[model samples]
Target: MKEFLTDPHQIERESMRIIQGHLQLDWTEQELKIVERCIHTSGDPSLEPVIRIHSQAIEAGLEALKRGALVITDVEMVRAGIAKKQLAQLGSTVECFLSDFQVAAQAAEWGITRSMAALRMNKERLKGAIVAIGNAPTALLEVLELAKDPQTRPALIVGIPVGFVGAKESKDLLWEEHQELPSITILGNRGGSPLAATCVNALIYLAVKREI
Candidate 1:
């Protein structure tokens, strides 16, 4: 146990333990994993992470992914964060269009973030997939728009895009505009690639084997 003292994640582990012991909150095992990972990623155990899942969306997301559903990410960092090898065992793949030429062209033409354009361009491909957006608020907005079309109904939307501009507003709109859709967002302007990727990884871990 000598290594535990210097482990980078030790503080995060202790913080979660304290929260779990002090709070009477009735979070499930899976939910607690998300919360702890969020805290670990952000280094703020006090940051109340928002979990807006409904009607067993967590279970649904895991099941959909296990059934070979596509996992689309707004940034390559998110794709990199996920345990793709474990996901591949279920015949699933991680996709990120940050480098797509069409996405860049579309974003430039519309004066929007390429991440948003990536979401827009993949409307058809998004259906029945799990979308995780962690960088641009515009990407969350575009997902909401595409979600309106019956053909673009994603299994779940993990919208924790981080920024000072339009981040909080975009997340609020996700709840206001599409409350019926299953979603998880880091409320306020306090989200990032790490938090978004953590949420996706949590869901994937439910159905896939992983090394801690």
Candidate 2:
């Protein structure tokens, strides 16, 4: 852990090369990078079948990201995992609403989890941005609800929060309630901060790999 911790890029690349030769993930070359990165992040091969994406989500996400849209996350860890060097070159950055002081105040007032309140507070910013929720199902649920407004809709939603309670239900609701929103989702409780962050980083990596 110490060796890789100091240089994640080297570890990630080396691991992916080894893993790629052994198991074939079912995705386009572009999409495969994201899956491979997620697996690399979690060290979980079982996630190959669980990570789900709409046919057009990647392309749409790529287009939005290429246009230099903001990447909004539910937590700070998700924001931190983004490749800042690559994103800086593209003139984009990651943001998380959860840490804002107003979110806590609003959460208390509204009787909602801070994640949900943070998302609600950032509705304007969420518009046309990439929404990545890693730690909270309430965040995804709020995003799905916000998407009912055409203006509040995100460019792409990464909905793979980890938990048994409301996690599966939140993703299912995103699928059932708002079919119009473009999204990447892990179709079960088997997801986490690393997996969610890797998806965002993967998109950024794909967009900037050749040039970076």
Q: Rate the local accuracy (lDDT) of all candidates.
A: 0.80, 0.83
What's model 1's lDDT at 173? 90
Candidate 2, residue 42: how far the Cα is off, in Å: 0.8
In terms of lDDT, the poorest run of 10 residues in model 2 is: 1-10
Cα lDDT tens digits, model 2, 75-165, are 9988888788888777898888787878888999999999989888878888889999898998888888898898899989999899999
Instruction: Sum up the clashes in candidate 1.
Output: 0
Name the Cα RMSD for model 2. 3.0
Error of 2 at 23 (Å): 3.2
Superposed by TM-score, candidate 2 places the C-alpha of residue 68 at a distance from the truth, in angstroms, of 1.0
Task: Identify the leading candidate in terms of TM-score.
Answer: 2
User: Which tens-of-lDDT digit does each residue in 161-197 have in candidate 1?
Assistant: 8889999999989866777888888788888888888
